[model samples]
Target chain A: MKIAIDAMGGDHAPEEIVKGVEMARDRYPELEFMLFGTESEVKPLIQSMDRLELIPTTEVIAMGDEPVKAMKEKQDSSLVQAANAVKEGKADALFSAGNTGALLSSAIFIVGRIRGVERPALATAFPAFGGPHREFVFMDLGANAENKPSHLYQYGILGTFYAESVMGISNPRVRLLNNGGEEDKGDDVHKAAHQLMKNTDAFNFLGNVEAREIMEGTADVVVADGFSGNATLKAIEGTALTMMGQIKEAIKGSGIRGILGALMLKPALKAMKHKMDFQENGGAVVLGVKAPVVKTHGSAKANAVANSMGQIQTMVEGKLVDKTAEFIKENADKLKVKKAAK
Target chain B: MKIAIDAMGGDHAPEEIVKGVEMARDRYPELEFMLFGTESEVKPLIQSMDRLELIPTTEVIAMGDEPVKAMKEKQDSSLVQAANAVKEGKADALFSAGNTGALLSSAIFIVGRIRGVERPALATAFPAFGGPHREFVFMDLGANAENKPSHLYQYGILGTFYAESVMGISNPRVRLLNNGGEEDKGDDVHKAAHQLMKNTDAFNFLGNVEAREIMEGTADVVVADGFSGNATLKAIEGTALTMMGQIKEAIKGSGIRGILGALMLKPALKAMKHKMDFQENGGAVVLGVKAPVVKTHGSAKANAVANSMGQIQTMVEGKLVDKTAEFIKENADKLKVKKAAK
Candidate 1:
């Protein structure tokens, strides 16, 4: 399997990107990487070229450029070129730690969407409490700020497929993220989406899941409109960070005894930190597209980038994108019939 | 001043409610309490009748009862009666730990909305990072699930007054909560609200606040449509609870060394826990109402209830509601002119 990497992106950029490729190539001998970037900038960063191929590109898309405009204008940029490689069937998947919007735009416009899909969603795994599974898939994490009930329903279907095929969950329990767990909860959009999800047998519908229940591992797939999803995601991230910071301050302010306690509690704290680290989840995936496209955080270093590569390899090997396309194709006629009835 | 208390509400009910009233009465010698509940259930719990008066009522609103219906049908209930006391000017303020929706309904219907206020909002203080002022107020927590741009603007006004008078922040930095801090970010509704806030001189309108910046002590009041506000609030609460649970598990699984470290770190943990506790912030206030009506957590104990009473006392003494009404009266013509222009 081959993966296309956007080398001139993220905080560390080509250096960490190349190191990550080398690490993945060493671990998975059958996998190959195509690095896209300016030759002079990326050449010195590559330690070994055993299973790696450099696809030189002249332009670079800056982090702050508008997504759609940048994707259209920077045709020769690394992000665009990397996405194009997947579009031309040169690679099975595409990976980037670039501007999220730009990567998503390239995925949708360049690589294209599944035939029956109206909009593509970005899915990230949120760490869950005590269960056989460590996390659950939460989708539409800011791909579209506004979504119709139909779009939300489609997210449920896409999220279910991604959870089952990529995350290896069987008959993945899918749920609509609502204000309350009751059937009559949420606004008109969520209410309509809930009913639609309930009538479908495509996945195990678990009804409404509230924000408080999200981290409790109540469902394998939690679907929401991008606005609420993005807000909830950021809230969790912010709270966790603030609490951790406060805890550190508290410990430090506790005098000499606190220092000794910290030393003894280092192992436990380390374990907790690892559990809270989102990088361990291997980043978010832009689902409903024709090919697998993964995006790591812009600040992601070698370990996170390598983990993202491994995640992409798994998606490719499991044929998750192909499965999604087949599922959408099978449902096309049913969806059309439903729409006609409506 | 007299404060009306719903003595038969919350998980602990009459016992904790009466206990909290006694605590408050002792702390504030000049203040009186009007306990609304069945005399049989509440009289036995009161420590002294010095400044306490039990107002007997037979009906009780359960936690699961629908809000508006319960408010209308259960007029004799403790929650309703407590709110009615404020409405009739028999009490300066009202406090309850009952069903939040029912309390809000009663506050709006019985106590009434301030003139020119479109909707009443639930505002709660979220713990902020290291500052002399420990928390910031987040409004429209779940009062109105859907809000117009006008309602959001009104929240900014209400939140500002509450922050200044009750929270003791001078010219508090108020912000509109959006997905991003960019000027043109968020959906159409938020964008319009941003423009409205930007044009207003009623409050200290900071451009925009993202969820990640909420806990960083960046703003004194963060305004959001109820949907996003509630989601963000619950996400923060859920993350804190989940992280605390995980940390406990981590310590337990680490053996004797971890156990000793935990013992040594007890004080630090206690301090951190206190900082994260929502009860420390004195519960949520029902803003835009004629009277100051505060809703404590449904499972609140004596400490939380007493803290809520203290909060209500502060509001009444500071005349926050009256100040809000005055602000609305002063701006009534300006708003009318703006609406006419629209």
Candidate 2:
């Protein structure tokens, strides 16, 4: 199977994307890559290879450009072109480290979404505690804001499918993220979703889980509206960064004694930092689409880019799309009630 | 000044609380502490100190009991008796490392609110990079759920007062805690609060601050509704703990190479861990009240209890209650707008 890579995306684009493609090609010699960008920009980065194919495109989308507007006006842009490659079946999947909104909009508008899906969601895997720990999937991380209760229920269904497909966890435990772990502690939307999840047999409803429980290995699939999920994710990221910076200053501030103590604790500290790193999870996948689309971090390095490519391969080879299709078809009536209510 | 201590509160109550009182008496020679609990529980622990007063009580609030129910029925409970001391003018203030919800209710319903106060908020100092570095004061940590726009504005005002009064910062900058740094990223409540803050002459309204900015020393006061603030705070704590655990495992997972790298990075890691520890922030202060009420952590040790007592002294000596009263009186018209809207 071939996957299209947005060569003009990311800070270290063209080079890192090319390196990632080469790494993937080395591992799976039968795998083909369709690199999209201007020949002049792509030539210096692409080493001579038979399987690596460069699809020439003159336009490129700047990182700061507005997504919806750029997608509408810049038809010839590399992001749009790469997406078109997936649409035309030239590649089975599309990967970009460009503007997240633009990549999502391009995938939905250009390649299109599944028939019954109302809105596509951006899904990410969170590492749980313990060995061979199963990852929990959450939808609409930042894709759709101001979600209705039905949207949240749909997210639960989609997230369950994604978890079962990728993590290979059968009958995954599904939970609604709330302020308090109690069922009655959330706002109106959360209360509505709580009832829906309880009534539906589409998922393994585990009841309300607090933000703290997310990291404590409470559920296999956590669901929420984009605003809360995105806010929670950003808050976690911010706190991790803030704590790291504080730890650095504090150890140094202790002068000699503090520095000595810090010296003794160094090994455990590095291990801690790596666990908090976002790169370890690869990147977020845009779910509910006709084909796989992975949106890596905009500032992703070579290793991050390589991991994202591997994620694409995992999704494609794991038949995640087919599993999602099957799940949707089997649970069509519940989804119908959900859609009607919306 | 005399302060009532709930000797029956917290995980290590009676024992730790007694030790903390002894430490406080030794530290502040002129200060007096009234230990509220059954005489049987307090007699064996501390019966010699001249400054240590014992106020006997019989009931106890279990850890799992609902706050309102506990407050209403456990009339002679240690937590209630402590609050009664504050209400009857026997003690200058009350301190408890107990059920936070129960403490909050007793303070509001029993001790009563300050005149003209619409709602009382819980404010906690989050240690920044280093050297105090302008600790962030967040309000309504868990007092009220489903907060309105006006409630957020009031939080900004009260939070600013706490920062300036307790932390000794002049004209503390106040920011709304939002999902993103952008002005337009929050929910309807945030948008409304944003407009109110800009127009009202009550604070030095800095715009919307993302979750990461809380630890980056961007604002002295980060205000939000209780639900979001509580969730965000807990999520941060959970992530830090998880990261610390993972880091330790990673260092031990591999062989000598990992051990050598871990050894080399010991000091740096220790420094990082120390910074994320929130216990250094003392306890969360209940702002916009008639008296200085400090809520210690449920798991607070002797040092944390001491920190809470120290905070009370700082506020009382500075006469922050009078200063905050003046500030509120001066901005009475603006505050009335909030009261009317709510």
lDDT of 2 by residue, B1-342 (tens): 888889998988888888887877777765789899878987799947688888889998766678889999999999999998899999888888888888999888988877666778888888665334546787777787677888788777788778887888888888888766566666777777787777777889988877656777778888877767777787778878877777667667755655665565566667566556666547888887777888888888887787678888887777766777787887788788766655
Question: What do the candidate models score in CA lDDT, each in turn?
Answer: 0.87, 0.79
Query: What is the DockQ for all candidates, taken in turn?
Result: 0.82, 0.37
Q: What TM-score does chain A reach in every model?
A: 0.97, 0.94
Candidate with the greatest lDDT versus the true structure: 1
Number of the top candidate by TM-score? 1
Give the TM-score comparing model 1 with the true structure, all chains together. 0.98
DockQ of 1: 0.82
Cα deviation of A105, candidate 2, in Å: 3.0
- Name the regions of candidate 1 deviating beyond 4 angstroms: A337-342, B130-132, B337-342
Candidate topping DockQ: 1
